[model samples]
Target chain A: MLGKFIAGKFLQYLIVIFLMLTLNFLLPRLMPGNPLVFLAGEDVGFMSSAEKEAILDKYGLNDSIIEQYGAYIKDIFTGDFGYSYQQKRPISELLMERLPWTMLLTGLGLVLSTIIGVMFGAISAWRRGTKTDANLLTVFMFLSAMPSFWVGMILVSIFSAQLGWLPVFGAESAWSNYSGIDRIIDIGKHLILPLATLILISVTSTFMIMRYSMLNVLGEDYIMMAKAKGVKEKVIKYKHAMRNALLPVATVFMLSLGFTLGGATVIETVFAYPGVGRLMFESVLSRDYPLIQATFLIITFSVVIANFLADLIYPLLDPKVGSRNG
Target chain B: MNTVLSVENLSTYFKTDKGIAKAVENVSFSLNKGEMLGLIGESGCGKTTVAQSILRLIEYPGKVVSGRVLLNGRDLIKASDKDLASMRWKEISVIPQSAMNALNPIFTIGDQIMESILIHENVSKREALKRTKTLLELVGIDGERWRSYPHEFSGGMKQRVAIAMALACNPKLVISDESTTGLDVLTQAQVIALIKNLQKKMDLSVILISHDLPMVTAICDKIAIMYAGNIVEWAPTEDILKNARHPYSQALLNASPDLGNPEKEVVSIPGSVPNLVNFPNSCRFHTRCPLAFDKCRQENPEFKEVRNGHYTACFLEGVGNHG
Candidate 1:
């Protein structure tokens, strides 16, 4: 039964990816524009008609829509994302360079925020109706309402422009030729503001959900039984109650992890970080069709895969799900 | 006989916007070692409250306003938090209502039982696991089933698991608070039988809290009938069954169906349990009592002994009338 369920889920995700790929190929082409113009940029006016034809031909833009789509599918399968018109480089190479920065920024932010948020949430729920709970609720409510970029800007104005404690933008010091740990430290310093912005903005949802979930679990008879059994207060709260409460939050964590992989565009833009989010933002503005398509496809696939994992892990977290499916 | 638990003038009240709801007021009962005392009551008569008060498990909006729960001579109400913690599973434990929700869904049955043993005893994990398997077997479940989660079991199995968990630390007293509530009739009977068997074999004192009068009459050594947070009558099983003094107790016996005497009418009590908020200091059952007189309304009757091991709180029983 478990094997069958996994197989079914895998099939569903595969369909989702196939549909996303088709849409990715079609959506960019459906936009009313000439890729040759985007490719030429300022050189568009100076380029002869013959040169323009050569450029279009090189990109296979002169082929029929169906023929181009077939090649697009084949190219994706072979790990080739074609070329970026705006950057004058391969789309795959551009993504490769930007993906790690996005991963570092969002990966660290997600891990830290989830740990801090889930812990605070559990504590807040445990101390429900108390001053600490009320205060946390108020702060998270404000954070949930505020935009990430606005938070980034405020943080920049305070920490960068005012105190000058951290860098205002970019992923590293531009002029530094520093190597070894110094270079690492320089990069680390630059990562702080955007990373902080991501954490503050993202943490509210997790905290709120966890608090709500924990409050529900606290009322379960098992928790009362645990208390009656003389289980330590900490063990009851963290192990018995929080373990069950974490079911819903696990899904939230997995979803955010997938979304974060695409990068926090607003945060990346605010910090001028050379991450995938920033790359996608620039691609959209310049209508770099290949880059935009490649980024969106990767993001969509990542989300589908993450959702699949959540489905697989849910039965482990909640045995009831497994029985029901079986 | 040595008393295992003695509850004296125990009162638990819930603070509400309307007023203080006297859930369990001036309740008193004593259970001898290895005795099964059935705390039988209507739905709102505060049976669970009395149990929680005894365990000192009452939380916010609810307080054990006035009580003395002496378990083996130690006053639990005044016991320090650490003292209480040490006593909880080791000295006394509860088999909660809805065994369905009483076992943590995420944890294995063995792990949950082992947790209780490991926390209170200076045993290694291996020793705890070994003890957990034995407890499961004692409760009529396969020792190997300890690895299963609550959801992996049937309702009866989950209840059995709950029973095993209750016995994890070999508690001197176990309170089964409607632990058989949601099970089918056969499952309920099986669970209760298991408890009775374990009680006898282990010499464990148990408070079987339920509204199932017939079941209580069958297994309990003594019975306390509650009416609107007051213990209207308390006596040995035979005395309560054959010579009930309180109006509520007699009414309860009349209401229950008799299998042997199939021709006998099953009559339900006339009125619903009274609301307890700011309840007047009079007979709580006066409105429902068929024999209620003006004197019954003028003052509350005291729970006084009329026969050896039999007590009742009713003016009709020739008890003193303060008014």
Candidate 2:
């Protein structure tokens, strides 16, 4: 029974992946403007028609739409995502260089937000109806409503320009003379503003969500049972209430991970950091078709994979879910 | 008889936005060692509130106004959180309603029981597991089922696991609050029987809270009927059925559907329980009581012992006593 259920869930993900890839292929073609024109630019008017046809033929754009799509799909299976016309480099190599930076910032942001948000949420729920809960809730509400870019700009203005405590833009080390510990210190200093901005804006939402979910779980009869059993209040909150509350948050966090990656495009550009979002922004300006397609494909695939993992994890986190399958 | 738990004039109220809601008003009772006391009432009659107050589990907005809960001569009303934590599970425990959802779904029954043991006692994991195995066996469940998750167990088995978890620390008193309310009839009988048998073997005092009068009468030595936050009548099980002094208790007994008396119509009370918020200043039950007279509306009746070991709070009963 368990094996069949597992296999059924795996089949569901396979179907989802197929649908996502089909959409990825179709949506870009449906959008107005030809990729060849966008990539070759208006300056190409000076060139001869034969020269343009040679360029198009070279890039496989001369083929029929169906034939081109079929070949593109075939290439995808072979680990080939084509070459960037603007960068004169493989799309995979560009993505490889930038993927680590995006992961480093967003991964750190997610971990920090979850820890601080859950801690605050649990404390606020435990002290419900108190002044502390009220004050903390008010602050989170304000922070959640505030736009991320505005918060980032303000933080840079105060901490970077005014205080002169950190560098304003770029992620490079400030002290060119220094190596080892000093270089690490400079990079850490540069990261403080962007990381803090991302974490501060995102943490409030997680805190509010976790607080609401925890409060609801705390009202369940199991919490009362724990209390009646004379379990410590801390145990009742953390072990029972918080653990149950984390189920919804885990799914939400997984969904948020995808959005966080896509949403950080503006934040990355603002900081001038060499991340996937920053690369995408630059690619759009230069009309790099291969780079754009590759970036979008990578992001779309990650999201689909993340959601699949979330679905698979639900049965493990909650036994009741698995029972339903049986 | 050795009295194990005594509640003296316990009054708990909630200060809501509307008004002061009197949840449990001047309720009093005592339980002797190895005795089962049944607390019966309709919804919103403050039966569960009384149990929660004893555990000091009432959170903000609900406060114990004036109460003395003496467990083996130690007053739980004024006890610190630390003191309550120490006494809980070790001396007094509770098997809450919704037994199926009470156990952590992620954990096995063995881990959940071991957690309780580890919390109050400093024991190794192997020792706790051994104790948990014995406890599972004691509750009529196979010890091999210890590794099973809560969702894997049936409703009756889940209740049994909850009972086993409650008895993990060998508490002197165990409170089961509507533990079998939502189970099937056969499951309910099995659970009640298991509790009765366990009570006898362990010599443990129990406070059984339920809406079913017949169920309570089956397992309880003493019974208390609460109406609008007040204990209107309390007496031994046999005396309550035979000579119930309070009109409410008489109404409740009359309302109980008896299988043997199929020819007779069931008698339900005329009105529902009074709202705690903005309740009339007069006797709370007067508005619902069929035998209430002018005197009942003029003043509230005090809980007074009218017969040997039987207490009732009603103007009609008071007048009968005086007459």
Candidate 3:
């Protein structure tokens, strides 16, 4: 049964990738602007008719849309994303350079949020109806409702400007040319504002979700059974109740992983971080079709993959889910 | 024989919006080693609450006021949280209702049982697993089936697994709270038989809490009937059925559907359980009692022994007979 579930999930991943690829190929073309106009700009007089035709032909812009789509599909299978007209570089290389920074920020943010959120949620639920729980829940509700960008601005204003504690923007030190530990420290310092903003905005919502889930699970007859069995409250919460409560949270986490990657575009731009979101923003402004298409494809693929993982994890958390397909 | 568990003057109430809703009032019972006591009551009569209170499992808004629950002479009500923790599962365990849901879906049955064993005993994984396998076999499941998850098992098998998990520590007392409520008749019988066989072999005391009087009558050595959070009558199983002195106990016997008397009509008690909030000031059961008198309306009855081993809380039983 376990082997079959894993194989099914693997197949699902492949299907998601295929769907994402199709979307990536189609969505960019649906937009208003033409690639040639964006690339050549208003200075079309610089090129002769022959040179212009040759440039169009070389880039496959002269081909019929169907033929171009077919060629795009074939190239995708060969791991070849087309060259960027604006940057004069392969789309793959551009993606490779910026992907790591986005991952670092979002990945670290998710991990920190999950840990803190689940812990606080469990504590609050355990102490339900108490002043501590009431205060914590109120704070969580307030934080979750606050906008991420607004929080970012406030954090930057206070932590960076007023306290002089950290840098407000960018991924690392631009002037020092530092590497290793110093570079990591500089990058860490630069990350504080965005990280705090993401954490503050996310932790409350996730904690609330976890708190509700924990409360519901704690009310299950089995929890009462555990208590009757004389199991300690700590063990009951951490072992029996929390494991059951985590099912919904796991699904939410998987969904959030996708949203965090694609959704952080505005946050990246605000922080001036050289992540994929920042790159996508720049690509849109520069009308760089190759860069835009590549970034969109990556984001779509990441989302699909995250959802696929979430689907796969459902059965592991709930045994009944395994029998659903069978 | 030494008493394995004792509960005295236990009263549990929930502070609701309306008022203090008494769930279990002045309820008391004792179980000797290797004895099986059946707690039978209508729905919402606090039978389950009595079982939960013994374990100190009652959650917030509900408080156990002025009670002494002693396990092997140690007062559980006065025991510290740490003391209670050490006593749980090691001394007393519970087979919870909804057997399938009781087992964590994420873990294998073996892992869950091993957790119970590990909590109380300092043993190696191999040793704990060996004991788990033995327990499964004892509960009439194949020892090899321990590796399987709960969803893999049928309802009866899942219930058996729960029983095995509860007995992992070989606790002195096992509280089965509606353990067979949702199972089919055949499965229910089989599970009860398995519990009976194991109880005898392990020499463990058990508090069997259920709404089905017939099932309890089949297995319990002693029986207690609860009505609106109080023990209306308590006696040896046969004595309670053959010569019930309490009006509530008589009503329950008449109400129970029995196979031997197919011609007899099913008699349901006239009224439902009284709402805990704003319950009658006198006897809580007086509003529903058929033989309630003027005295019963004005004053609550106190528990008094009607016979050497039989007790009832009712003013109708004549004050002189109580002694």
lDDT at residue A264 of model 1 (Cα atoms): 86
Query: What DockQ does predicted model 1 obtain?
Result: 0.73
DockQ of each: 0.73, 0.62, 0.50
lDDT, residue B232, model 1: 88
Candidate 3's residue-wise lDDT over B126-203, tens digit each? 999999999999888999988888889999999999999889888999999889978999999999998888899889
Better of 1 and 2 by DockQ: 1
lDDT of 2 by residue, B8-27 (tens): 99999999999999899899
lDDT of 2 by residue, A1-326 (tens): 87787788788878877777777776656766666665577867787889889888998879898888898789788889889888888887888877877887777888899888988987888788899999999988898888888988998999888988888887666447768988778777877888888898889978988898889888887787778766787878778888889887887788877654543776787787777887878776766666777777878878877777776778888877867886
Cα lDDT computed for each candidate against the true fold: 0.91, 0.85, 0.85
lDDT of 1 at A278: 88
Best by TM-score: 2
TM-score of each: 0.92, 0.93, 0.90
Off by over 4 Å in 3: A1-8, A33-37, A40-59, A85-89, A259-263, A285-288, A307-326, B121-125, B201-203, B319-323
The model with the greater lDDT, 1 or 3, is 1
Task: Encode model 1's per-residue lDDT on A230-282: one tens digit a residue.
Answer: 88898888788888999888988899878876998999998999999989999
lDDT of 3 by residue, A253-320 (tens): 88888865653776788888888887888888877766777788777777877887777777767877
lDDT of 1 by residue, B1-323 (tens): 89999999999999999999999998988999999999999898999999999989899889999979999999999999999999999999999999998988888888889989988999999999989888888888999888888888999999999999999888999999999988999999999999999999999999999999999999999999998999989999999988888878888889999988999898988878889999999999999988889988889998888889898888877644321
Which RMSD values do the candidates have, in order? 3.1, 2.7, 3.5
